[model samples]
Target: EDQVTQSPEALRLQEGESSSLNCSYTVSGLRGLFWYRQDPGKGPEFLFTLYSAGEEKEKERLKATLTKKESFLHITAPKPEDSATYLCAVQAYSNNDMRFGAGTRLTVKP
Candidate 1:
């Protein structure tokens, strides 16, 4: 079975503070790792797709990196606007559907 677990279900940071969210997973065979951000009453917005270990993608103050067993979403000097629920998912080569983590809720205070 494939499963994902995200730590620190919630986070609070002062404006301009930096932190990282963790996503750990276990799969039969990793096809891809995906990162997304979701806002209240809105669907998740795609952030990055990691195809293999050691691969990374970045946008603005956010960076997503992947490894053999886990992935990390790094937030740098985040502002209030950066606050949202960050989601992580993984697809296994043997399965067509993706398994997702519970998501990490981040609040950046101004």
Candidate 2:
């Protein structure tokens, strides 16, 4: 079975502050790792996909990096608009099942 754990269940930040969210996992065989952002009452929006260790992706103020044991979503110069829940999910090479973490809720105050 695949397992995923995220750190800092909640975070509070000031506008323009930078921080990172962590996602750790244990899987039989990793196929891909994904990051997403979700706002209240809305579906998650896809952020990045990491296929292998050392891979990284970036969009706007968000940068995602992956390692063999974990993945990180780095938020740089965040604003109030960046406040949301970040999700991390992993897919295994063995099956179509995807495992997800509890998520990290970030609050950026302006």
1-110: candidate 1 lDDT, tens digit per residue: 89999987999999999999999999998999999899999999999999999998999999999899899999999999999999999999997998999999999999
Candidate 1 ranges with C-alpha deviation above 4 Å: none
Q: Estimate each model's TM-score.
A: 0.98, 0.98
Clashes of 1: 0
lDDT of 1: 0.95
lDDT of 2: 0.95
Can you write out model 2's per-residue Cα lDDT over 1-110, one digit (the tens) per residue?
A: 69999999999999998999999999988999999899999999999999999999999999999999999999999999999999999999999977989999999998
Runs of candidate 2 exceeding 4 Å displacement? none
Residue 95 error, candidate 2, Å: 1.0
